[model samples]
Target: MLFGASDSYSADEKMQITVAFTRFGKNLVQRMPRVRFGFVHVVNNDYRHWIMSAIGGSSHPTIISHGNRFRAPRNIAAKEVCKREYATEQEWKNWDWRSEGDLMLNGAIFTQSGDPKAAKKFGGYRMIAYKPAHMVPLLVRWSGTLECRPNKPC
Candidate 1:
């Protein structure tokens, strides 16, 4: 059996904490056992920035699983994309700034760190854009039974 959980975040506010959970049952097939994985799916441009910042700065085994579907309009100047798309400068200020695209997903094997505090130092909006008072935590949790009997499985 496969189990999963999901959550959403807002672009205007820093995501104080985000978590993902998964459960797995013993594999019935003789093929290689599947390991639990976590994914962070971002919808809007702002959400994408936050997620990317977290993944890029994290020391964990996180990686970009899928990229955005929309590419920047090459015909327009690079700086114009945000100004035209967003109504206010404030809305576009904290954005990823580098590229103009939407939709993103980052994946990592769920492994809890002994030091939860380590997350604070990781590269993310909490460190870059927000002040200490506005900081937040992004946590991913994975748990499940593995094919290895009586052995520790990740």
Candidate 2:
């Protein structure tokens, strides 16, 4: 995938995604997935780096972040884990964005909004099972770049 989110899309083309057991390491645009449109469920994972925020979004996307470990970057200003792109307070105030069971570290914060009943409604839906935050290191310890023995078949 490219470093940034781009392209034109229609309402029907929106996606519903589940991000689980993923190792989100150094990258740009907050070093994590930037939700554009549709439903997204981000489950247990290791977040190690970011420039702006961890999980960004726009266009009134419904996002549910749960059980993820967010180790924010050293920059104090970049501690927030959720960033809304090009939207005003009144605009994004009602979008369905919620974070539960997430472990925020180093001042990381996730601003949730909309649908208090969302949890009461969607909380029972366990489409993807994830372990507790402490197990993330063991689950993704071997992830990231694979050193293919320089100049080898890699």
| Local accuracy of candidate 2 as per-residue lDDT tens digits, 108-140 | 888889985565445556446657787887888
Clashing pairs in 2: none
Top TM-score prediction, candidate number: 2
The lDDT for every candidate, in the order shown, is 0.23, 0.75
Q: What would the C-alpha RMSD of candidate 1 be, to one decimal place?
A: 16.5
Best by lDDT: 2
List the pairs of residues colliding in candidate 1. Answer: 16-136, 16-137
Q: Estimate each model's TM-score.
A: 0.16, 0.80
